[model samples]
Every structure is written in C-alpha cells, then in structure tokens.
Target chain A: MRNCISCQIKAKVEQRNEDLNAKLAFLTMPQPASFSDVVLFADDDDEHPVPVPAHKAVLANRSPVLRAMLDNEMKESLSGTIKIGDVSYDALRAFINYLYTAEVCLDQQLACELLVMSEKFLVQHLKDFCQKFLVSNLNLDNSLSTYTFAHQHNFKPIIDAALTQITASMDKLASQDEYTVLKERDLGLLLEIYEAYFSKQADTTMYI
Target chain B: MRNCISCQIKAKVEQRNEDLNAKLAFLTMPQPASFSDVVLFADDDDEHPVPVPAHKAVLANRSPVLRAMLDNEMKESLSGTIKIGDVSYDALRAFINYLYTAEVCLDQQLACELLVMSEKFLVQHLKDFCQKFLVSNLNLDNSLSTYTFAHQHNFKPIIDAALTQITASMDKLASQDEYTVLKERDLGLLLEIYEAYFSKQADTTMYI
Candidate 1:
C-alpha cells in the first residue's frame, strides 16, 4: 500500500514535468509550421523589420490588451499585423514566445524590456515574473534606477523592494552614478529614499 | 529581512496561480472567436457532425499523430478538418481542451475514453492522467475489465495495480460477470491471474 502511494506521487511528478515540456515544445512549433494568423513587427520605424508569426487566439487569450486589439475592428485586426514600437526584435520574440509557454531566459535588459511590455500588454503573470526577477537581482548599484523604473510603472512591490535595498546602503547610494542620475531626473524619488533611510535610522536608534 | 523573504515567497505563489489561470482561460477563447484554422468532427459517419473549431498549431504541437497528419499533404490537412472516429463530442472537446490547458474534469467513462485516445495519439501526459485515475478507482468489480484494457495497451503500472487488486480478492474475482467475460475472451489473462494468485498464496505459506 505504501509502495503504491509512493508510485502515484512519482507518477504525478513525472506527468507534471511531461506537461511542462509539452507546452514548452508547443512554443517552438509556431515558427516553422506557417499556420500563424498574425505577424508582429518590432520597431515600426525600421525599414526592414523582422516579422514574428503568431496565432491571434494565443495572443488574445494571454493578454486582455492584445485581445481588445484583435477582437475589435482595429487596424491591427484588419491587417493581420501588429507593429510594436521601441522594442528590439529579440525582446518582441521572447515576449510572444513567453505567451505561448510561460518560459523566458531573463537577463537584466531583457527582463526590463519584458517588464515594460508586460505592463503595456496587461499581462500580470509576466509582469510578476519580471518584477520578481528584478527584485531578486536588485543591489546597491541598480537599486536607484530600478526604483525609478518601478515608480514610473507604479509597481508598488518593486518600488518597496528597491527602496529597501536603497535605504539599507544609504552611505554608498550617493557615490553611485545612478544616484546622480536619479537626483537629477527624479529628485522626488531620491528624497523618498532619504526619508525612508532616516526613518529606518530613527527606528534603529529607538530600538537601541 | 525575514518579512521581505516571506513576501517574495507569497508573491511567487500568487504569480504561479496567475500563470495557471491565464493558460486555463486560453482554452476557452477558441469558440465564437473564429480564429481557428481547423475544425474537428467527433465521428465521420454522422451526417451532421458538430464542428469543434481548434487551432491546427495547438493540435499538432500536442500530439505527434496530429502533427504528422497536419504537417503532411494529407486529406485532413488539405481539408483543414479532422475526423476522430468512435469518440463522443464531449470526450473529444475535453481531450482538445486538455491539450491546451492541461486541465480536465474526469469521470470513469471519460477517463477510459481519453486513455484510449491519448494512447492512439501518443499523448503520454494525458495517458498518464487517465491511467492514474483508473488505477486509483480500481476495485474488485472493475479489476478484470481494467486489467484487460491495460493489457491491450501494455500499460504496465495499471496492469500491476489491477493484478494486485484481483489476486487479493480471488473469491470475488471469479464470481463477477466480468470474470466470465474475461475467461471467454482471453483465457490467458484469466490463467495469468490464477497463476499470480497461487504464487502470492505460496509466498504467504512460505512466510508462515
């Protein structure tokens, strides 16, 4: 009986892994198969843009923004083409691929790009993914810039996380190059960091 | 710091749930949207079969048999319609939806139908799902028939589990109407059960 129960657990885990791999493979099948209903181009200004073929049903199902765009008699829906401005082809491809399979290889730049795209597309899952990645990878060097980016999007969790990182290293924050940029462009954010840092300092002093 | 770490874990769980929900909703978008490239008919013989609209990419990606059929210059491919014979409309819809979302509401009969279809289509994940369902639901009443079904497909784990159930209740196994059916259709399977029962009985005797 014990052995049978253990086998069931093992089989369940195996099936889960197979399910994930199958969905991951589903992402790869779209490129070469040529059944895609729509083509997405990155950076509409580029004279010769690389087009990524995708299914409208998949894109719409994943994102309400995409659904609204495709569901209505919009220019994109009429033309069977969507032109996204200010994104690299690789980032666009990665974003669309992530729609098919919730899998992406994230570096700092790609994560930021996806973060912006997810926000734009109203894809909360990808937004959460990119936010978590950015939050975990935050350090003194990137905290100020990340905080600014998060502030622009009003991503509260990321803002709080970045503020925590920034306030923890207030002494070194001023010496960083991003500190100068943040102070010049967004003095309010720098002030918020200072307020947070001094409040934390006061709390520590009271505790002592 | 501890609070932040706990928050991150909570956020991760939330993100995973959102991801799952997004994919689940993806399965519901094919109907009435009209973006599907192909339609599947449950049975070919019906004069007026209800069409199940589905993306060819999704169907092809999930099952190698479907992929082979769609990728080649076959009748189904050319016609952009697939006729899955001997499966009920509900079962076929659930099967295709499972391919998209990896979610299904299974009953014993539906599980058996899907198990056969999954094996036919070489979809191991769904096969595992149905096999586990049947194995967990196995009892003395259904043991002989389930064992025979598993034997037909050479599903080893289900076969072993059914045999265990059958040999444990040897008295009940012989009295059931399915036992008579099994004896007539496949005497070898019946003999194998008898051989297993006696072997187990001998082991108990040796232990004593």
Candidate 2:
C-alpha cells in the first residue's frame, strides 16, 4: 500500500511538470499570422471556439463608455461615416489589438489614429493624444488640416485647441512675410483663426 | 420677364437665409437627445449632409490604435476577457465622446481614466498620463498595486517603471517596522516582489 501511494505521487509530479512545460511552450511561441485562415484553425467538431454570444464578447472586449458613445453617435449622426485623418489602417488595427490583448505598439501614424479614434469614441486619452499630436506637429500645412477636420467634426474643444495651436503657429508665421501672404490666401487658415478667436471670445463672455 | 427674374433671385436669397438660420439653430441648441441621429437624418434627407457608413462610423468613433489593438486581441486571444479598471472606462468614454463631438471635460477622474485607458489602448497621451499619474502618486500601497497589475498584464516597460517606483517606496518602507512586519506576513507582496525582481534579473541576463 505504501509503494502504491509513492508511485501515484511520482506520476502526479511528472504530470504537473509536463503541464508547466506545455504552458511555457505556449508563452514562448511566435505570434501567429495576421489572416484568419492562415493562422487559426477552426475546430472540426464545433462551429466556434467557445459558445459565448457575439454581443457579450463585444461588450466584454469594449469599454462601456466607448460602447455607449458608439451607440449614441450611431443614433445621432445622420451620416454614419466619421472622417478620420492622419490615422492609417495599420494603426487602427493595432489599437483594436490592444483592446483585446492589453498590448500595443506605438508609432507616429498609430499615435495620430489613436487620437482621432479617441475623439470619435469619446475616449479621453485618444483626444489628449490628438491634442498633443496637433500641438507637437503644429505647422502651417498640418495645422490647417487639423483645424478644418476639428471644425467639420464639430469637435468644438478640439477645434478650439487646434485653433489655439494654429493661432500660435500663425503668430510665429505672422513674423514672416511668406507666412503672412500664405495665411491671407489660405482660406482654411483664415477661417480657422477667425473661428478660434471668436470662439475664445464667446467662451470668455459666457463665463463672465 | 426681368421682374420675374428679380423675384426668383429674392426667393433664392430667402432660401439661403433660411438654411443659415436652421444651421444656427442647430449650433445654438444643446445637443439633441440623439445628435448622431439628427446628423444621420440630415445626411439621408438633405444634400448638404454627407453619407457615412455604419462600419466606418464604428471605426471613426473609436481610437484607431485602440480599435486596431482590439481587433488584434480579438483575433489572437479569441477567448480571453480583459479586466479594465474604473479609470480606464472613464477615459475611454470621454475620449470616444470627444471623437464624436470634439469636446471634452477634463476632470480629475476623467484624466485618470484617460490615462488608464490610454495604457490599455496603447494610446501615447494616455500612456504619458499613466506614467505621470504613477510618478505623482508614487507611494507604497499604490505602487504595489500598480506593479502587480502591470506585471500581470505583461506590460514590461511599465512594470520596469513601476518596479523603480516600488523600490523607491520600499526604501521608504524599509525604515518602518510596521511595513517590515506586514511584508513578512503578506504572501502576495512577497511573491510579487520575488517574481518581479527575479523576472527582471532573467531579462537582464537574457539581454547580456
């Protein structure tokens, strides 16, 4: 009886060590391919991996605030398409990945996309990023685009922030003759500055 | 014929003014119960509003990087659930709202949420805020929680950063008898510190 008990204990230890090895192997494995068919294998016996509902998965994966915002915007916007710029397809893909894995790779384009999406989703971090990106990349050309996009989206605060950025850039540009001529002819810049300054005045008046 | 033409021009002017008034009304009005709904209705019925697709709307309303991260994680984890903190939810929602409306209210909670969600979504500004928050809130209890969470999530750099924070706090705690006694009894803390320090050493050795 003692010999039988000792043998069982030995077998259990071996099994545990094997399980640990398997787990380590999984952790060390290289990431799979991007495309579904090439990377993941669909179970032959089952239609799906887990029988969890799609909506539940989405809810579980998405932030409650983002889900609410998406629903709200979908309800509110007559046009469903929200225009996003300075954000590429890859960056969008990366953000989605992070939502799932809590992991992400940051880059310039990804940074821009993160900002635009954050603004669209009412994600504060993304908006701050967009603001910072606009502020950091504030220049004659980009600022104009940022200003126009913010206004078009009715992102008044972003518009205001971008406008402030543009105004600051404009101040710097005003010192140069080339920028002055460019600002005069650039209808986008002119409109952005006018809107930004006026909004600021309006905001101050409301507070007063 | 000349009188008729003049009358037609006046009618056109009246229509233009009416259109402008409607736009002004929209701008002046507090956000309608369904702002996106109004926009969607306008886009469908009026020539002025552009058509936006549902999927694109989803994309536009989400942080691109976050969205991408979500997608990637969805593909990779396939069956994993992400546990989000309270702060992350707030930031994500605020950011999403900004994306849709381009306006944000910066409150302490909102800022903290944004920071947490940014780290989750891999948004730079959010990450920066998370770092800033960590730096500002550097203390034994908070750092311990931060370190443990960061480690669990496999946030290498963040874990490293948090470790530095933990060490600094530990240095302070080491002087206190209560902390040492607590540390002896707290298995979770002991395990966490052991694993963190050992893993870090392993990483350093691998690099070497």
Candidate 3:
C-alpha cells in the first residue's frame, strides 16, 4: 500500500501487504518503552504489569509522554508516596486508562475519584474533560457530588460554569417536591452552596 | 458479566456500554435506501461494511446528532449537487470517527481536511481538539497551517489564546530572524489577526 504521509491513508497497490507490514513494523517497535521501571519490573512474558486491557494497553504503549508520566508517578509513589487525592490504586488505574484511551469504564463514584486524582496530579486535560462531562450531565439533585468535587479540587472554572447552569434552573430544582424533601433532610450543605454563590454574585456586582 | 445498570456499582456507573453501542450502531447503519430516488449506497455488504481499520476510522460511529448531520449533508449533496469544499464521503466518515473516538489515524493533511469539515459542521469539540493538536505539533515553518485553521474557523477564542502564548514568547517568536521570515511569508494574515485582537483589547480597555 502507498501511504500518504499528509493524510495517513493507505492506497491499494500490488505490494500493499509488504508496504503495510513494513510500516506496521516500524510503527510497532514498542514505541520506546515509556515506563522503564514498569517495563523492567514486568516479566517479559507478561503483557502488562498493570492489569489494563490489551487494546488500551496498546494505546498507552504508543504514547511515550503518557508512559513517562505514569513511570514518574509510580516512582514517586514508591519512593515517598504521592497522594492523588483520595484515589486508591483502582481509581489511579482508571485515570491512566482515560488518559491513554479516552475511554473510561467506571462508576460515577470512581469518576469523581479520578477527577480528584486528575486535580491532585495536575492532569489538566483530564480535569478539563471531567469538568465538561459534569457540566453536560448536570442534574440539580444529583449534582451535589460533582459540586463537592468542583469545590474540593478548587476547579474554579468548572465551579463557575456549573453555578451558572444550576442557578438558571433554580426554580425547577426548588419545585421538585422529592428534591425539596431531600434538601429539607440535609439543608446545611445546600444552604452553604446557595449562600456562597449568592455572596459571590454580590461581590461581583459590588466590584462593578 | 453484569451490565452497568444492573451491576453492584449501579449507583456509581456514569455511563453504560449499551448507550455507546446503540449510538455507534445508529451511526453505522446504512443510509436510507432511497433519498428522493437518489439511492445513496455503500459498497460493502450491509452486514460487513468497509472496515477502515480501528485506528483510521476515528469517528466511525458517533453520536446520533453527528450521524444525523452527516446523513443530512449527504442528502443535501445528492439533491443540490453542490460541493463547495474539499470534504469527500471518506473524509466525512473519518471526521465522524475522530469525533466519536477522540483520535484519528489520518495524516496531517487529512487531519486538516477533517478539521475544516468539523468547523463547517459546527462540531466545536472536534474543532477545538484539532486546533490544539495542530498548535502543539507546530514548528515555525509549519505554523502557517495552524494559523490558517484559526482564521478559517473564526476560532477567535483559540486564536486569541494562541496569540497570547506566542506573544508571551515574544523573544522567541519575534526574534530578528523569525520576525523577518514571518513578516515576509504570512504578513497579511498575521496583520489581520493582530488588528482584530488589538481592537478587542482596545474595546475591553475602553469598557474598563
């Protein structure tokens, strides 16, 4: 196959198989192992030292920068134990997968956990993705968990964005009879968020 | 294995596999057999459509919104026979895959083509990703392409952001050698962006 360098398309030719295999071989030379320790520690026969799936593992393998980051993270953890918020090993693994594959298969709780980890680890891209996801999927009743993440991580941009969205729907949120009951049950945090946002608005207007 | 909704992690599950699968299936389904008698078609068997390889088909199966947009585009093309841009059927397919998968295995030229299509289609997320990729991968000589994308898409936000970054590195970007080369090679567009941004800044200052 003739490969177009500009667009990476493969054109059919009599020597397609030979050309493709050659190109694949060049592209697949293990992409210069990013996590030297991970690579070194794993048995040669073992596919992945960390238990990520094969497809995702291949994606991770191709990204040398991401691999290096993971290696550095592991090294730091082993040497002095760096904390990624309240994330456990599982959450860290999921976050790594999300970074490499942009495919995360985790529960909302784990997603929140990974968002916290993304913040602690200074994974700005991951944090941005998480914030976007939260904003796109916000539900007033269920948003408390996401709000907590926004608050705790000091993801001020995300908090600002979410507040705009939630505040716009304040009447609908208040009208939800079931949610009103739940708010009555746990009014402290709810009141705190309201007061905080209102004060923030007041401060902005005062500045104006 | 149990699915997300029925699994022990039900409460935590943020996304379900079925949701993604359903979306993908919808995207891949063949266009209606008869669109006003034009009869849009695919070459491969309906059961096994053209497999553009996993990596190459970045947006192979995307959200229904994007798929609908593509279908409408195809229908419009068939009806009006107006092809203004360089977008081809294959390019549109690849662009869709890039949207869904967040990765495209196309070459730089094809990627640029897809980026233009994304902008035309109002796929802001894809446009943003493409712009970021182009900027990060750019060199002084090759940076013109990134600038072109910024100009064409009216991606003012990205352009403004890039200008801030580049100007912040004025010592590097505006060195004697670099400044002379850029002035001679890209003077028109450079001045345009400069004037637009400077005017915006002036407006903000006046308001302040």
Candidate 4:
C-alpha cells in the first residue's frame, strides 16, 4: 500500500514537472497573437535598446522589488517599460526568461551577473541557484573572487563554502595572483580568512 | 560525493517548486495595474459571468487547444474574452490557477470536473492528477460509476483500476444500487467486468 502511494506521488510529480516545462514555451516561443504588456531594456544598450518583451504580471509575481515598482504606479508601471540598470542585454534576457521559466543556463560569468541581479531584486531562489553554482564550481583560482563577491552581497552560504575551500588550502591560495589583489583591496576579509583557518586548526588539533 | 549530488538536486527541485508557487500569485492576485489582457467567462454563469482576468500568454502556453484558439486570429483573440464551455466558475478559476502554479486542491467532484476540462483542453497533467485521485479513491461504491466515467473518456488507468476493484469483490458490487444503474446504462461494461473476474478465477485455478 505504501509503495502504491509512493508510486502515485512519483507519477504525479513527474507529470507536474512535464507540465511546468511545457509552460516555458510561452516565453521561448511567444506568439504574436499573445499580447506582451511590458518591455524591459538593459542599461548597457544606450543607443538602440532591444526591448525584451514580457508580461508585467510575471515580473511582478517573481520579484517583490518588481512588484513594488509595478504596483505603485511608478515610472515603470506607467510607461510599461522597465529599464534595468547595470545589467547587460544577455543577463537581462536570461533574468527575464528565468522569471517566466525558472530555468537558466549559467556559466561562471553569467552566474555572477545573475547572482547580483537576484540579490538586487530579492529573488531568493535565483540567489540560491547562483550561489550553489558558484559553490560547486569553486576551486583555488576562483575562491578568492567568489568569496569577495559573496561577501559584498552578504550571502552566507557562498561565504561559508568559499571560506572552507580557501582555508583548506591556504598555502596554495596565498601564492595566487587573486589572493594578492584581495589582500590589497580588502585586508579585513583577508584577516578574517586567517582567523577562520587558525580556528579550524585549533578544532582539528583538539580532536587529534 | 553521490549523496552530495543527490542533496544538491533535491535542494534545486525544492527551490524550483517554491519559484513555481510564487508564479501562481499572478493568477490569484491580479492587480489592476498589472494589465491583464484577457478575461475568461464560465458557461454555467449566464446571467452575469464573473470575468476571470488572465494573460493570453498563460492560457496559450498551458494548452494547445487554447493556443490554437488564440493563435489563428479567432474571436477569443480579437475580443480578448474567452468563454469556457461546460465548466463552473470555480473549476475555471482552479484550472487557470493550476496552469499558472501547477498546484490545486482537488476533491472528488472537482477532480472529476477538472478531468473533463483537462480532456477537452488536452491538459494531460490534470487528467493524470484526476485519474490518480479516482484510482486511489476507488471502492465498491464508486468503482462502477468511476469505471463508466473512465470508459466514456477512454481513460485506461481509471478503467483498469476500477476493473481490479470490481472483479476483486464481484458479489458486493453486484448487489449495489450503482450496479443496477451500470447494467441499465452500459451492459457491455458489466460483461467486461464479469469476464475479468472469470479470467482472474481461471488464473487462480491454474495455480491451484
């Protein structure tokens, strides 16, 4: 009986996932007959901004910051045009597509760009996604820069994960080019890393 | 390492589920400022149909029937009003909500109603949901009627499940009020049930 229930639930979940994926076609293949009520522009495109056509309700539903902007009869709500500053056209397209589909292909650069956008917009799920991507892709080369970026946003998960990576191989990390840049730009963060390293050392010593 | 990957995938699924739920708020809470481009009317409400405000993209995206209606410069596309036939206002709302959120609270009656709507609209997920609901809820009381309903729709899963239940307790099913109704309405289905029962009996006899 329990197995039957389990199988039922599994089937239901699979069906729902398929349905959700089908929903993404609305964004990917927007029929001209379907009305798009709003357009978003990326800040980097100053001369001829290519409008990313979207639905206001979708943007408002996905992000509270966007909801507030659209809800308050702000310039964006009245104009039906939202100009997203500090975002490249590709990142803006990816972000808006994610709003509709909740799926995005992320490289490290794109992940970093999206993580900032997610933080700025208070899109926690996207933030978590980007954070996980950064964490999983963390290595000696990128740990310092990833940690710095995570610290700027106060993302604790990425901070902790990156810190663990950094402290685990402090010897190799200290000799890297990015580590010198981090030490010069943010000595406080550098000191904190050393402190964490010694604290981890103390714990390991006590156990030994 | 395998456990870590499993945990990451689980977390990603949970985050996507949450993001999908958040998207449903657009259907539930439509701000006048958000500019809903279409209104849907339920057929059951003739006097003054409550307009279910929605987006064309959402409707067209969720169902191919709706997409065809809106895509070919149909009256629904031109007028921005869709009249959903043979559905109650509540069911229409629930159906649209499910399109946006991939979530619904289904009772037996609502599940039946949604199943019919799903079939008409070719919404496979909702049909699967309703089929699972009926299958799990199958018993002597509902098996005959459920089998009839499933037979009408050509829903094989529900028909097979109902057959299993009916054949398992043929004596009790034969004495029920619904059995007389099923005999009157669809004698062929009753014969099929008996045939299935005898087949089971033959299998058991062969084993013995």
Candidate 5:
C-alpha cells in the first residue's frame, strides 16, 4: 500500500513534468523567418565576414553583455555590425542559433568553444550546459585541459569536478604526454592539480 | 535492487527535465526592448490605441498566421500596424505577451478569450493551455458556456469533457440562468446537449 501510494505520487509528478515539458516546447522559439535588425560577425571570417543577422531584442534578452552593447548605442550597435573576435564562423553561428532556440548539438570541441563564448556573453544557461557537457566528457586524457579551461572561465563547480577526476587518475596523469605539456605551459595548473590530489589523499586518511 | 534501479532512472529523468527547463528559460525572449518593426493594436482601444511594439522575428516564429501576414507583404506588413478586432487592450496585451513568453496567468474569462485568440492565430500551444485551464475550471455553472465556447472553436477535448460534466448534471443544468439564455439564443446547442446525454446513457447501458 505504501509503495502504491508512492507510485501514485510519482505518476502525479510525471504528469506535472509532462506539462512543464510541453510548456518548454511551446516556449522554445524557432529562428526568425526574416526581418532581422542586427548583424553579428565572427572576425575569423576575414575581410568580408559572413554576417549572422538577428533581432536586437533576442540578443539583448539572452545576453547581458549583448544587452549593454545594444542599449548603450555602442559603436557596434550604431554601425549595426558586431564583430566578435577569436570565434570561428561555425562557433558564432551555433552561439547565435543557441540564443534563438536554446538548443546546441555539442561535441567536445564545440562544447568548449561555446562554453567560452557563453561566458563572454554572460549567458549562464549556455555556460552551465557547456560545463555539464565538458564534465560528462572529462577523462584522464582531457581532465587537465578541461581543468585549465574551467579555471580560465572562473567556474567553481567545473574546477571541483575536473580536479576530482584529475586527482583520481594522478598516477596515469604523470604518464600522459599532455601532462608534460600542461606542466610546461602552466606550472600553476600542475601545482593546483597536485594540491587537489594531496587534499583528496588527506581526506581519505582522515576517513580511515 | 529493483527500487534502487528505478530511483536512479527517475533521478536521471529529473536531471534531464531540469536541463530542458533551463533551456526553456534561456529561449524565452523578453518582449522587444525598443527595436520593434511591428506594432499591434486592439480594435476596442480605437480612440487612442496604445500600440504594443514587437519584433517581426518573434511574431513570425510564434504564429504561422502572423508569419504569413508579415511575409506576404500585406497591408499590415506594409504599415507595420496590425489591428486585431474584438479584443480588449488587456486581452490583446496578454495574448501578445504569451506569444513572446509562452506564459499567462489565466482566470476563466481570460482563458476563454485567449483560447479564441489562440485558435484564430493557429497558436496550438496557447489554445491547448487555455483549453486545459477551462476544462480544469469547468463546473455545473460554467459547463454550458464552456461547451458552447468549445463548439464554436471546434475544440474536441474541451467539448467532450464539458459535455460529460453537463450530462451528469442535466437536472441542475436546466435550472441554471445561463441555461435559459443558451436555450433561447441557441436551441441547436440545447439539442446537442440532449443528444450527448442520450449517447452517454446508451454507452452506460451497454457497459452495464
């Protein structure tokens, strides 16, 4: 009887979940069919950048960084051309599309690129999504690089997660070629990794 | 062990649901912050209609009717002025806001008005939302009105649900003031009510 009652509660929650899901579906907007009032350019596209046309309202709503730029009547807003430096055309496209639809097909590389972009734009949702993707995909091979990236982005959850993954595989980490490169590129990061490993070791000893 | 596995599965589903909810929040664009290409007017506010400025992109993405109107280079598209007849300023505002946000706090009257608006514009999500609200709020007092409203809008689910409620309270339905109004204004609706009641009776008898 108790399990049956619990099952009934679960069913009710599931129904509410379905309702929320339908609401989400209804809210996820399709990309504009036309009538765009702003254009974004990924500088990597060179002299004649491929312009991503979008509505200012959408850009402003999605990103506080973009909102400030648009609202302040900045050079980019006035000239009606936003040149985002360092991002590839594809990344910019996916980023803009995500702002419109809140959907992205992420690979490891795309996830990293978008996470960085999401941070720059102050789009926390996309940042969280990218962080989750990277965390899920983290391995001994990628953990150091991910840890560095997460550190660069000022992501606490990601740092803690990556450090946990890195510390767990510290022995194998020393054997990896990338580990040697990381030590050379950023000794600080290597120190932090060792520190996390030591801290975890101390915690284990305390447990014992 | 079985319960453990089920709990793990439920946890995963809930995590996915959270991801989807975050996506929905990100995708819900705030109504246009000044760069509006189209203005909507409630015809009831004829004297000095307070124009609600909105982006063509948002309007087009939300409703096919709006998309067609904007894309086909019609008069409304040409002037950027859409005159929606038969709606109060409040209903029109709420309707447009719902188009942007997929959210509305609905009471019965607003729900009915929005249902009509949603049907007219082919916004199925809003129509379903309003239909759900009306059905959930349905009772002996509002059953005939809801049934009539559903019939006019060709809402099958609401029609069936309202009919069920009405048929179960036939004696009470006849005594209601709105019943007298409906019987006089639309005798056909009364005939449909009797027909539904008889049909239900036959089905009940067959089950017995």
Candidate 6:
C-alpha cells in the first residue's frame, strides 16, 4: 500500500501546483517580436529611435496610464510611436519586459529606476515589488539616499524604514561625507535627520 | 522586540508570495471583448455562428493546432473566422476562457468533452487537468461509460482508473443498464471486460 504520510497532503499541494502552473502557462505572453501595433523608443536614442515592438492590448492591459495614452487619439496613438524621455534603453526594455512577464533582476539602482517608472506609469504592482525590494535591502550605507528617494516619491514604508535605520546609528552621523553634503545641499533634510535622532532617543529614555 | 521565530521564515515566504501575485496580476488578462483579431464559432451554429472573439497571438500561444491554422495562409486565417466542429457553444466559450485564464468549473460530462477538445488542440496542460478531474471523480456508477470514453480517446490513466473501479464491482456489473447496452453496442468492449476479469482472478490466485 502507498504510505499514507506526507504525500497524502502533498497530493493536494501538487493539485494546486498544477492549477497555478496551467494558469501561468495560459497567462504568460512571449515577447511579441511580430504583429506589433506600437513601438517605444528610449529618449537617449535621439538620432534614430531604437524601436521596441509591442502589442497595444498588452500594454493597455498592464497599465491604466498606458491604456489612456493608447486609447485616446493622441499624437502617439496617431504616429504609432511613443518617445519615453529620461530613461536608458536597458531600463526601458526591462520595463516593457516586466509589463509582459513580471520578471526582472534588480539591484539597488535598477530597483530605484523601475520604482520611479512604475509610479509614473501607475503600475501599482510593479511599484510595490520595487518598494519591497528596496525596503528589505536597506542598510546604513544606503539609508540616507533611500530616505531622500522615499521622501521624493512619498513612499511611506520606505521613509519609515530608512528613518529608523538612519536614526538608530546616530553616533557616527556627523562624520560621514553625506552628512556634509546634506548640510550644504539641503539643510532642511539634515535638520529632519536631527529631529528623528532626538525623537528616537526620547522614546528610548521614556521606556527606561 | 518582534518575535524572530516566525518573522525570519515568513519574510521569505512573503517575498515568494509577492512574486507569484505580481506574475498572476500581469498574466491574468480581462476577457478580450473588443479588438479581437479572430473569431471562433461552434460548428452547430451553422447559419449565424455566435462569434467568440479572440486574439490570434493568444490563440496561437495556447494551442499548437490553433497556431498552425492562424500562422499559415488558410481560409480561416484569411477570413479571420475559425469554425470548431463537434462542440457546444458553451464548451467552446469555456475552452477559450480556459485558454485565457486556465480556470473552469467542471462537471463529468464537461470534463470529458474538454478532455477531447484539449487533446484535439494539443493543449497538453488542459488535457492533463481534465483527465485528472475525470479520474478523481470515477466511481462504479460512471466507470463503465467512463471506461468507454477513455478507451475511445486512448487516455491511459482514466482507462486504468475506470477499469479498476469496474472490475472491483463485478458482482453488481451484470445488473446495470450500461452493462446491457455495452453488450449490445460494443461487444468487443464487453469481451475485453471478461478478459480483464479473468486476468485479475488469475493474478489474485497467483498471489494467494
């Protein structure tokens, strides 16, 4: 007799796994190298726009912002070309690939860029993915930069996390090169750091 | 301090969950109600086939048979109409929906029909899903007919499962109306059952 052990439960797990695998097979689209209705060009490609072919339906389905842009009789819709400014070709390609496949390899830099693009395009799922990556990877070295980036983008979780990290290690705060840069470039941001540090100290003292 | 026991492991699980959720979101397409490049009609809809709109790219991706029909310059491809014979309109719609979403609420009859269709289309994933459903739902009541259906389609798993169920309840088999019908309609299948029964007896005798 087949042992009535972990496999009995594993059978259920395997069934669910099969269901998701089928769904994924149904949903995942291979990058459309043909029959493309529109093309996207990176801003850096000025002399000749490097074209990235895509289906309008797929683009519109993934992003409401893209849907609006393509659905309306805009200049881009009429011309069949979308010129995306202030982005590298690599980032633009990854962005489109993620829209189609939702798979990307991210470092700190790529995550920041994708997060900004996800926000601008109103792809909330991608934005959340990037935010989670950034938050999980936070450390002393990148805390100040992440805090500033989070502040600029109104990322509440990242702001809270970066603030916590920055204030927790305030003993060496004044000796860092970024400390001088922040003091000179944005005194308001520097003062906010002081506020966070003092507030954390007061909270600890109260607990004691 | 937050408990470390669960959080340490939960953080990894949550990351994986987030990845899957994002992929699902990217892959789950809304039904293409408009801008469909191709239309499928059930063969029964002779005069005015109730058109089920779909994209060629999606159709081609899901089924190699559909891909071949759409990719080559055929009459259906030229006219942008595909006629699917020997299927109900409801089944055809559900088939297309499953191709899009990989989801369906199945009954025995529906599962059989879909298994046949999935096989015809060479969609192995859907074929396996329908086969598993039919195999799991097999019982003495349905085993004879299920056996015949599975036999016709050369579905080995279902055939084996139904055969096992049918042979186990040989005492009640002669009383069923399906047994009488099988005797009249397909004598070969009836003889095969006797062969199976005797073979099982010999095996049991050997074990003893």
Best by TM-score: 5
TM-scores for all candidates? 0.83, 0.28, 0.31, 0.80, 0.91, 0.89
The whole-model lDDT of each prediction reads 0.82, 0.45, 0.49, 0.82, 0.85, 0.83
Docking class of 2: incorrect
Cα lDDT of model 5 by residue, B29-124, tens digit: 655547778999999886988998888877887889998998878998899999998888889989988887888999999998898899889999
Q: Compared with the real two-chain complex, what DockQ does model 3 have?
A: 0.01
Q: Write the per-residue lDDT of candidate 3 for residues A68-95, one digit (tens) a residue.
A: 4445445632442222333455766666
Candidate 1: what lDDT? 0.82
The sequence of per-residue lDDT tens digits that candidate 4 reaches over residues B121-200 is 98876777788899999977788888888899888989999999989887797788878887888899889988999999
Candidate 5 positional error at B133, Å = 1.6
**What ranges in model 1 sit over 4 Å off?**
A1-34, A206-208, B1-34, B206-208
Give the worst 10-residue stretch by lDDT in candidate 5 chain A.
A24-33
Best prediction by lDDT = 5
What ranking of all candidate models by TM-score puts the best one first?
5, 6, 1, 4, 3, 2
Candidate 1 accuracy as TM-score: 0.83
Quote the true-contact fraction of every model.
0.20, 0.00, 0.00, 0.14, 0.79, 0.38
Q: In candidate 2, what are the lDDT values of residues B90-206, reduced to their tens digit?
A: 444454443333235564445445555555554543455455555565456555555555555555665667676665444464555544664776667556665766676788899
Report the lDDT of model 6 for residue A39.
Answer: 92
Candidate 2 per-residue C-alpha lDDT over A77-184 given as tens digits, one digit per residue, 9 for 90 to 100? 223222223445455555444343323455545655666666555545335545555556656556555655555556665566666766655546355554466576
Off by over 4 Å in 6: A1-11, A14-19, A72-75, A175-177, B1-22
Q: Of models 1 and 5, which has the larger lDDT? A: 5
Report RMSD for candidate 1.
4.5
Give per-residue CA lDDT, model 4, range A102-140, as digits (tens): 678999999999999999998877887898899999998
TM-score, second chain, candidate 4: 0.83
Report model 6's TM-score to 2 decimal places: 0.89
Off by over 4 Å in 2: A1-61, A64-88, A101-109, A119-125, A136-141, A169-189, A195-208, B1-208
lDDT of candidate 1 over B1-208, digit per residue (tens): 5578757765675565556555444433344235778988898336788888888878887798998998868888899999998899989988888777666789888998899899999887788889989999998778888998889978899999999999888778778998888778899999999999899999999999
Among these predictions, the greatest DockQ belongs to: 5
Q: Is candidate 1 or candidate 3 better by TM-score?
A: 1
